[model samples]
Target: MTLNSGRGLLAALGLLAMAGSLPTFAIAQQAGQEGTPQAVPVVVAPVEMRPVAGALDVVGKISAIDRVDIQARVEGFLQDVSFEEGGTVAEGDVLFRIEPDEFEAAVTQAQGQLDAAVAQQSLAQVQLDRAQQLLDKKVDSQMTRDQAKAAYDSAVAEVKVSEGALRSAQINLGYTTITAPVAGVVGRAAITKGNVVGPASGPLTTIVSQDPIHALFQISETDFRNLRDRASADPDNVKVTVGFSDGTEYDQTGSIDFIDATVNQSTDTILGRAQFPNADGVLRDGQLVRVKLESGTPEERALVAQGAIIADQGGLYVFVVEDGKAARRTIKIGNTVDTDVVVRDGLAEGDMVIIDGLERVRPGAPVLAQPAPDAASSGQIPAAETEADAAPAAADDKG
Candidate 1:
């Protein structure tokens, strides 16, 4: 071969060799990228068996156990209001006073009439006795004796009439002072001092009992039947919990003490009432609230944190760590109690559900799972194991 041709041949061979190495390098780079999958860090909690309550949610209103409207029974000017406006008062406490001048004068006149009737009765008795003695002696005529007896009887009747009048007048005098009929907190005074108030007056004021308030609600016929069936098994199982408008729950639990016998004709609903102690005065009359009526019977069910749930067009779903990877699961959620949701289906005990770092997770992605602080403390998993399992995955991510 010629020198130039040999040199050209060697260069062509080298070029072919370089072209072969390029594809090998490209394949190696692709393989490396595929081998190291991204590990998503997530906080997880194990599905646990807890006692979940079967409950019905409804809206309700708070009401006072006892309410009364104060009114003046006697016609008089309001002399004074003895109770503080919007303050608590005990039963039989004087709430208002009326002018007693007229009532007192009536009582005095009645007493004077009674005294006169008594004197007349005494005189009649004396006359009757004298007539009887004279008739026994044959001095007085029979007709005169009969007249004296009649007069005595008339006097006795008059005395009885006077006594009745006195009693009525005394009652009227007592009515001048109006007192609280029930122990409760008094509302604004409708009739202030110096205003003429009488039985015809609409109302002087209003009072409502504060403690042991009532929660009134209505339920559909179906719900009523369900409640009846549940209550038949356990009469005292009807428990109620109330939530205020601000989303804070009332501390006290109540019992279902009243249920109407007839369903509402217009709405086909049944009225129900639950009584709760309101010593703290947190509940107010006629305030709208949310009510949760739960059966006391405990039920075993799998539960997960509320934050773990996600939704899509299909329905509610959650991400569970399976084989060290995130797997999407469609769950049938039942009732929610507090911060946990009852899982009716599609979840098993011991499954680790992702509660935190869900934004970074995708289906089938490798995960660096660690038990949430709350879940770890609940004995679901050991804290040391969670930390140990997370360390290698974190190092791999860094590397």
Candidate 2:
């Protein structure tokens, strides 16, 4: 072959080799691009409509409906203590017995005097009758008959006086036995047997009714005005629930029974009272508790899981999926009920709020959203969220 033909042949071979490798390189580059990650996976829930109440929370104290102090009415040595300390008692039940020797003797003396007066009155009546008969026959003077009549009147008056004395003596005798003035549970006795007791003596014991208890609380003037306005609009809407210091909630619900007519000058607050049916006797007098009051009729409000809420310098916000993209929205918040918060503004029903994978989410970022596990059974997002998720929103909103 010629030199030029040899060179052309070598060039043709080189060209063919380069063409053979180009398709493999192109395939590798395409595979690498296809392996890149997709949008971040997230859990989301839909906003819901629920009935909500404007509620106020405050500290309160439990008190009894009826309380009394037991004291002696008469003077005598306490011969016997007839009741068990810290036990239930009924009205008119005897609690103590004082020595009755002196009182009994006075009663006996008064009775004897009354009997003697009655005999004297009988004898005087007989004498007056005889004197009247003699005067009719003109055997006795009119002066004698007049004297007999005066004696009979005097005896009648004496009988009445004796009767009064007897009644007084009997009352004093009855006072020797002390009885309970009301039905309730009695406290420890201040006086025991052999102690002298009288009206001047201090209270011997205390008794307090055990059922239908009262819960007393105080509210600021502003809150009181709001409550009064709400009450005026709906009188039967105010309801109260109590919680103990140990984080236990009371089962029975109560109603507001009283509000003080005058405001307290020192605190600038008003006193309020709620009545609770304490059939179980779980409540006691002077017990500190947490009181929550909900007033006004139930109204429709938008609610979202607390986890879905977010916060920034501007205000509280949340991320919602729109057209498969995360959209940041500012929201106004209201009272918290359970795991959900009432969204006063900026959210609508059926809006999908990002709950899980919040750390990976950003405003305007694309997301692959799925219902949270708790909401899977309902075929939608849950109505409430964990309290930990709600904390940031509360702080940002200053709620």
Candidate 3:
């Protein structure tokens, strides 16, 4: 390098270093030449008001509306199990058959005794009539008539006793053939054929009614009060729908039919039961399910798409374009319905929220807002594409 050129370069560097703000002044001049900053483009939609109802979710257990235990009413060897295990049975259908030989013999013996008693009663009545006739004709003494009357009365009492014994035998014979007390699905047999079963035996099996099944659940007392307030006439009639653990929803809806008389003090919850129609028998006893309750009259609520919601350590927030500038709004949210979320606070109807191109804008920055293609005044969200979701939308607007 030439000595003169090297000396000149060193002198320039020294002058620039001595006046450091000279570079900053030159950059400011360059920015002035560039004019105004361009406004960021954003997609926007309006907030909307829609009817919403309060909801509560709780776990439930399926139960039969009517449950019965089958047992032998008479003592004898079980000759047959007349039902298929886990099969449906109609009321009055035979479920078991105990050996009938002994019952039949007792019935026969009792019938014979009743016949003998009837014969004796007739003979005694004839004797009493003859004795009375003789006394009226002065051919028999009063004592003779009286004695005949006594014998007749005794014979009548014996006949009455025998009739009772016969009825008892017939009842026992009927009991030997066990019948279902209600129409329901039967569980596994506790005893098999050839086993001795009688009144002393425990339940031979169980039966649970299927249609109009019960879903048992628990609710806090506060919730019960809220539900009752929703429907004053029927506290238990609050509407409920069920879902399975696998996220499949039950087709039929249920209503609360019963509330336990007492509260479970330890848990501070009251037991509630909802009845659902199960004509297809899809609901089974002891099954677990999710129960969602809808209560209270529908109230107007502002709703926004779930995609517009943003959460952070400070809770949740969304963006809106206000006065031609991108604005941020912190929101308190409630239960979500479909893709729409209930906005409990921090937003109002007709608010233009910025939902897209959020990465290019900041709070209070100029934005070029455009309507989301699916946007509408109604609470329904415009279907969106191209990755901008989780906030409101806005485009540049003149203040």
Best by lDDT: 1
What's model 1's lDDT at 62?
A: 97
Candidate 2 regions with alpha-carbon error over 4 angstroms: 1-51, 135-143, 232-235, 262-269, 298-399
Q: 1-399, model 3: which lDDT tens digit per residue? A: 999999999999998887998888899988765654457787887887899887677889999989999888889999999999989999999999999999999999999999999999999999999999999999999999999999999999999999999999999999988899999999999998998998888999999999989999999999878777777757554668888876667899898788899999899999988899999998999999888788778889898877778888999999986666668999998765545778999999878777778778778776666677776444344334112422233222221
- lDDT scores for all predictions? 0.87, 0.84, 0.84
lDDT of 2 at 397: 31
Clash number for every model?
0, 0, 21
TM of each candidate vs. truth: 0.67, 0.61, 0.64
> What tens-digit string does per-residue lDDT give for candidate 2 at 1-399?
999999999999999999998998899888766764345577888888989877777899999999998888889999988899988899999998989999999999999999999999999999999999999999999999999999999999999999999999999999888898888789998998998999899998898887889999999999888876876745367879998876667999998888888999999999999999987789988999988788887799999987778888899999987655678999998755556778999999978888889998877655667777666678664333323333333343322
Residue 237, candidate 2: alpha-carbon lDDT: 75
- lDDT by residue (tens digit), candidate 1, 118-188: 99999999999999999999998999999999999999999999999999999989998889989888999
Off by over 4 Å in 3: 1-51, 232-237, 260-267, 297-399
- Which of candidates 1 and 3 is the stronger one according to lDDT? 1
